[model samples]
Target: MKTLKGIKTHPLVQRLQWVFNPVKYMETNVQEDRDIFKTTVTGKGGLIFVNSPEGIQELLTHDTKEFSAPGSVNGILRPLLGDQSVILLDGDRHKRQRKLLMPPFHGERMRNYGELIQKITRSAAAKWKPGQAFIARNTMQEITLAVILQAVFGIYEGSRYDELKQLITSLLAVTDSPVSSSLLFFTALQKDWGAWSPWGRFLRIRQKVDKLLFAEIEERRQNWDENRTDILSLMMAARDEDGQPMTDEELRDELLTLLFAGHETTATAMAWALYWVYREPKVYEKLIQELETLPENADPMTIFRLPYLTAVCNEALRIYPVGMLTFPRVVKEPTEFMGYQLEAGGVLVGCIYLLHHREDLYPEPKQFKPERFLERKFSPYEFCPFGAGVRQCIGMALAQFEMKLALAQILRDYDLTLLEKTPVKPARRGVTLSPVGGIKMMMNGKRTPSKSVAVPATV
Candidate 1:
């Protein structure tokens, strides 16, 4: 097994552009070890995977200034999300766009959603009974969609909420199965025609969502409601540093991105947390004991302070990261990563999946242990499931808070277990990772997060 360190750019490395599904290919036998040192994926083919903590730091923290988002992502997502989307921008433009979008995801701002989180989760959990199987992802998605809708629109029910939910749900239906697709970010595919022709379905769904959003924008504009507390209101009221208001198109793009990014990833994280803790009784017991210490009526701050719960969330993210890769970065100038002399315009990806599972950084990386996060500090590069740098996920804190609270609330009540005894591996679904068949789990009953810690899942 040759390490990528001394290896020259092999012929396979040069042909990486021809590779359509790089992530699925990541595990296949290409890199001699498959643990590290996969081929560089740029036109110049000098990409290197130094899964070391040090390498993670150099690339994500130190070298980030040089790397621009690969043109690949800009090509795919921009069409769906629009050129003004936060995902599409780079450099200063990215910074400004992020700033405008940051308020909704801020810690203080997110704190207000805690009640809604518990309420929504509880509401969804009410319908289930023991012996009846439920898809964990669907439960999480329904709750997440409702919670995000309330937070984004201030309309918890009524025709508006229903209409918006239906439209958004319909749009998401295409990719909601969460199956891994190899074609997520292939830049050249923009020129390639689909064999079956997907544009018609894509356009039809796009029109449905757009019509709903544009209609909402128009309604809000007509009435000009200042009392609305949802994200839409914030966007309506928001003006840039120069006091220039965002256009309706800008509003649609940002709102749509938030709805898409904010909801699904959090739901997936919640589902994985449930699975890992249930599968490992010891871990579940520890989490219960720690959670039990909190007051029955503990506020959002107390839940946020629970160290073990935070660790659990961190570990779940580590084991099966919802997002396997970071926003791509292109080589700005000739550089050497891990002594592989790479030329300018080379492609580099922040291979988050590989880094999280690195044995040196995480001893027994495959094990489900939350204590690793507590024992030592991992460089931002090593532990960045949400990514690092100024371009980090805006909803990182919000997602963590939501996951911790949501899981604590659920675990405190319902006794749940995985429907199967075997483990399910992760694959990229749309832009996030989802379990195959959406994780079948049986809920024993509900327990409020404040009372008994780890209640026994009903036998």
Candidate 2:
């Protein structure tokens, strides 16, 4: 494992925000160079960096139970989710919540949602016009948002879908800007002039989304729908060992967590994947070729099998993961890592960005190459875009499926090129990390590669 026995800092560095120059100061620095170096965040904020594959493994695995995700990994989300949110819970409560939610995202029931994902992707892809500049991030956001709605509500439509979409758009607009991430480091500043402040204005919008969610929960409760299988319906029907249903408050928190998380971060990742494929045409070509080999209207598992596309998406996430750090876990007993003794409750950031860009494991780490994934597969800790340990993203499978289907659908119909020669790096998108300036690109429509049939975006 790589290590720097000491940490260095300058006075000017202390005043900086982690969100402002995230890749510049942390993940990028670690990516373009060595692993296991102690670095200063703002001059005062110090973290022990583990950029090497092996070091990353130790941080995420091995003694994982010791290093808890602490501080502001979910700071911006706290106001919305409250302390009862699964993201805030640890140990037993976390286990129970995770268990309760797990069933909905699994089994053949989950597979049933793939057709909906494909339909949504097709609808969105059909909107692209040749010669027009399309903002990849925005497009993917719409696609994933629609998919999540259907996945969560078992087919949302009419006033509710439009209302929900509008509310979510408003809520995300505040968080999507680079400013929200900066709030993590400076709570007082945010309370004053920060974009997350009331002046930036997201509360009214969130309440609207929440109102719809709770109202739906209430309606469902008044008329229990046994036919429904989406999370909200399942949660409504769920009873603990005591044969008691979950309260509205518990239901609300879980719904809010899934509703907010379901679409936002996945949208960011899909956007980045599109940008990388366009920015690096060869990678896009490879993805297209691989996607072509899939059977007509392939199943989700088959989508997962498109090795090149899978590698490209995975690597895109590794390079520009939406969430910068993993969920916090605290040490219950004394432990040692990086040759330093750690006490219980000691904080550790999962630092996925730094780990993915490790120079030693990923030579010329910044280059967009998906083959590295095929060349050698790193352990979960080494390239954990969705994080590792038991707390790894519950929606990882869902997110990956969406990316593959969406990308495959888009590439099948249109060919695109970068509108700007120089690319923007990932900056904080609200509570997530995404392309800084929005991935601006122009479309180049191509008919089916194998056959001459026209491909329409809508199902």
Candidate 3:
């Protein structure tokens, strides 16, 4: 067995780069070792970052056997999402939690939220007047946040709902930038000095959010309505093989997990879609042309099925996957990977950002070309924006649904312009990458409904 190679940079410097400028960090390191490399940025023992599709496939496909998706490896997120989140569970426990939570985000149950998604988007758009400048990410966040809240709680309006919305937003904002995101990376920085300190401020807001979550959980427990379809209610009623319900602590953690994962990532993807669409006139015109063919008052599923719209969303997610890295998968036993020997307890992660940008897989990888998707179908291992295998994002179906429907409604009804001439770059936002400056834009005017027409072959 040969020793695995890694970045030559000092551990401290690599860790700093990982926290402060992860894109640069990964790009520079991958240039040194394209397929696989080790780095201590994640922790003391170091983690193996795998960029090859085969390696990622092997790592994810045998996750339950050759590799174990241990919750302890995801300790970096425990502070924000709590310990009991499906994101933080392993083995049978993880499978059971996913079983209970999966229903609300998939199948017909997910489709039920389509009308509500469009309604939220339209309501959000109504607030913007012609010539109004807005941060696309912030605007989209409001829309996605509302949709997730309603789906989770089954209520869109109320004092607790409004307060939870505000508190959760505030809680996440504390880590909106790389500097602030550092608190999550370095345990030493997590000290709560006071309300004025970054970590302190995060703790205070999180406390408030927790109080509200527990209150909602406790209130629902008292009522225990079997008819309620909201995620929280469903979770409360869910019984394990042992016939036990999720505890309040478990409920609180999972709720935070759903909000953070379901809301922020989808909003960033939508914002980027808007950026790419408006930035390229051909793409925008072509998308509108495709959307125009839909009959008046088209249902959400029809809008979702539009090929160009699906490609556009696919390209956006591919260009800058909201989650840069999948949760870490630890080796269950000594195994060979990509020509190198690996030992048990070794940590490995699928570098989603790097994989998506591979020039071999995507020609002119940096260029946003929805046609790539339209021209050919890529294997799941090659084109995964959501991580693959057992730990794949549970909200994958709903996020895609929300993206297509929201983009269709917004583009169909409103004419918006990108404000910046220069291309925007992705920056670290907590654990994920988001558009720098949130992709500023301005509303031009609303477009009148166009009659159904023949679809064009090209833009």
89 Cα displacement, candidate 2 (Å)? 0.6
lDDT of 2 by residue, 36-138 (tens): 5545653433455565656566666654355655424455577667566777676667777777777777767667777888888878877888878888888
Residue 157, candidate 1: how far off, in angstroms? Answer: 1.8
Superposed by TM-score, candidate 3 places the C-alpha of residue 197 at a distance from the truth, in angstroms, of: 2.1
What's the lDDT for candidate 1? 0.71
Model 3: residue 171 alpha-carbon error in angstroms: 0.5
For model 1, give the 10-residue run with minimal summed lDDT: 178-187
Against the correct fold, how does model 3 do in TM-score?
0.96
Q: Give the TM-score of candidate 1.
A: 0.87
What order do candidates take by TM-score, descending?
3, 2, 1
Candidate 3 lDDT score at position 439? 85
- Top candidate, metric lDDT: 3
Give the candidate order by descending lDDT: 3, 1, 2
Q: What does candidate 1's lDDT look like per residue over 173-271, in tens digits? A: 545543213233444443434434354455566777788788888988999878666777877787778887778887888877777787888889888
- Candidate 2 error regions (>4 Å): 1-15, 27-33, 37-47, 62-65, 68-76, 183-185, 189-200, 451-459
In model 3, pairs of residues that clash are: none
